[model samples]
Target: MQSLTNRQKRFLKSKAHHLNPIFQVGKQGVTDEMAKQINFALEARELIKVNVLRNADVDAKEAGELLQQKTGAELIQTIGHIVVLYKPSENEPTIQLP
Candidate 1:
């Protein structure tokens, strides 16, 4: 996956700040189904946030990396149990590319 430009990363971070997570990774971490769902979400939204449940032993960064790998999404940021990812939709995106 291509890395987001610094400006794009900053813009995405600000845009995502107010939105709630669309998906949650629980004690099971990320299942194949969850990965598929994430990929689908990325195709639609380009940018998304995921919540990692407290019971999960995986660190937030690790979870972020795993999700990025599985979904071919960029790891925009990871704070606490929340992860932010971005992947340009195949079609033109409604969200501005920074």
Candidate 2:
């Protein structure tokens, strides 16, 4: 997939406005298991939010980047403890970026 444009980022943020975080990174940070779960969720949901708890060993940005690298998902945004990720499904993408 190509890099998301500024407009695409804004569009994704709006689409994810009301969605709750599907995964949480705690003191363990972005474990492989957590990345797997996130990848699975992204395959099913296209766009998803992840929350990095305050007590997490890693910073929100670090955890988000780790997950993005491991899961091949794009980090759309990181607001406070929340991280937004997007990866279009190969077979059937659910979110159409602008």
Please list the Cα RMSD from the true structure of every candidate, rounded to 1 decimal place: 1.1, 0.8
Best by TM-score: 2
Error of 1 at 62 (Å): 0.7
Q: What is the lDDT for 12 in model 2?
A: 92
TM-score of every candidate relative to the true structure: 0.92, 0.96
Clashing pairs in 1: none
Candidate 2: C-alpha RMSD to true structure equals: 0.8
lDDT value, residue 12 of candidate 1: 91
Model 2, 1-98: lDDT tens digits are: 78989999999999989999978899878888888888888989999999999999998899889998999999999999999999999889877766
User: Residue 60 CA error for candidate 2 (Å)?
Assistant: 0.9
Tally clashes: model 2: 0
Question: In angstroms, how far off is 6's CA in candidate 1?
Answer: 1.4
Q: Give candidate 2's whole-model lDDT.
A: 0.90
